[model samples]
Target: MSPYSQEVLKYLNLGIESELQAYVFYKKVMEKINDEETLEAVRKLAEDEKHHFLQLEDEYDKSVRSEMWAPYRDIMRKEGLPDIDEHISETHKELLARVDKLKTKREIFEVALELEKEAYELFAGFYEKTDDEEAKKLFQFLMNFEKGHVLTVENMLKNL
Candidate 1:
């Protein structure tokens, strides 16, 4: 994999980790919110995160053949490490960590918005750099997805 792909992969996983945290956080927020609209908004954001997760998984899977880690994956593995698969679900743990960092509903939204915006820029920059049609298309799709997350969170906040 090229340096560009590696960079994009890192950013994509970052977003995935954030989204997992967002999903659980937002689900908790829904419990605190009595307004139907606010609850709906939270649920929508959760769904959007789930969608983004699936998209990233599909794209990442394409890069790794036969369901095996590619060179890029190996590079991310620490030196003298057991194997990348050992940390294969690192994103899951990351999400839990982020959730542990949050103590309030507003904090969850703030962290989620920050993560989405960063992800948008990261994917958008990658989309602009690549001339590969398929890669560009995938990145663009991700860019829109992240931006949509920002909008969803903002709307939820406004409703609250």
Candidate 2:
């Protein structure tokens, strides 16, 4: 496998894991929210994260796995690739720990805004780093979705 393919697989794995984390975070926040409007908005965000994860996973499967990327995986295993868990941000860890303690709409919106901003940055960085046209397009799509999420969360925070 080319070094490029290996790099894309690494990015896809990070993106997939991040999306799953975001989905879980939003769902947890939803449980603490009592307002119907806020809940609906958060639910939509969670669904978007789920969709992002599926999209990234599909891309990974199509791009790498179908073409015998397993050898690369084996090499990664032999070299002991760093765990995905270690890539999670400290802010996210803190938020997950305190999710249940978020008692007000403003507080919840603040957390949501932070998460959305982080996601936007993550995708933007990915988009910037990749030279492959297909990977660039995919990352750009994710970046656009994350940008919209940031806007939505910012609006929600403003209203609170």
Candidate 3:
């Protein structure tokens, strides 16, 4: 039995999928970038997406079962943990295709900014719909992080 409502679980799954897709997209974009500053910025964005995916996965596991959650926490606490599975879904492959089309630093940053804005909207909607304090807090945290990413990407675009 899950602790979260089915709707909550649905949102969590959406978040998990989106974050993983973003991480892969950023990773692919990093491969095309030659400028040191842009490469570093994109790398940071990839790292942030990876972290968000982990956090959302953790929350999902906890909602589903404690036994399923403990190993993840343990692994996360350990030194030199392995990277998350990089299985690209069909949807993710489409994202990668879009990333492949990006030809300039500005194009990359513009796409990133749009992605961050969408994430912010998603989190904001989830936060508004949830009455559960824990879920609300999680959504709020994600919203703040996404908002920050949007600002960072906007600034990067301006500098490009």
Instruction: Tell how far residue 51 is off in model 1, in angstroms.
Output: 1.7
Cα deviation of 89, candidate 1, in Å: 7.9
lDDT of 1: 0.60
Tens-digit lDDT string for candidate 2 (1-160): 5334777778887887677668767867877888798888988888788678767766787766563334323322332121223343343576578787888888887877777788878878888888888888888899899899989988988887
Q: Which candidate leads the pack in TM-score?
A: 3
Residue 62 in model 1: lDDT: 61
Off by over 4 Å in 1: 1-35, 66-104
Q: What is the per-residue lDDT of model 3 for residues 39-140, given as tens digits with 9 covering 90 to 100? A: 888888877887887898888987785454343345334433234344423557777779889998888888888888888899899888877788888889
How should the candidates be ordered by lDDT, best one leading?
3, 2, 1
Best by lDDT: 3
lDDT of each: 0.60, 0.73, 0.77
Model 2 lDDT, residue 56, Cα: 78
Deviation from native of the Cα of residue 30 in model 3, angstroms: 0.1
Worst 10 residues of 3 by lDDT: 75-84
Could you tell me every candidate's TM-score relative to the true structure?
0.61, 0.77, 0.85
- Candidate ranking (TM-score, best to worst): 3, 2, 1
TM-score of structure candidate 1: 0.61
Q: Residue 65 deviation, candidate 1, in Å?
A: 3.1
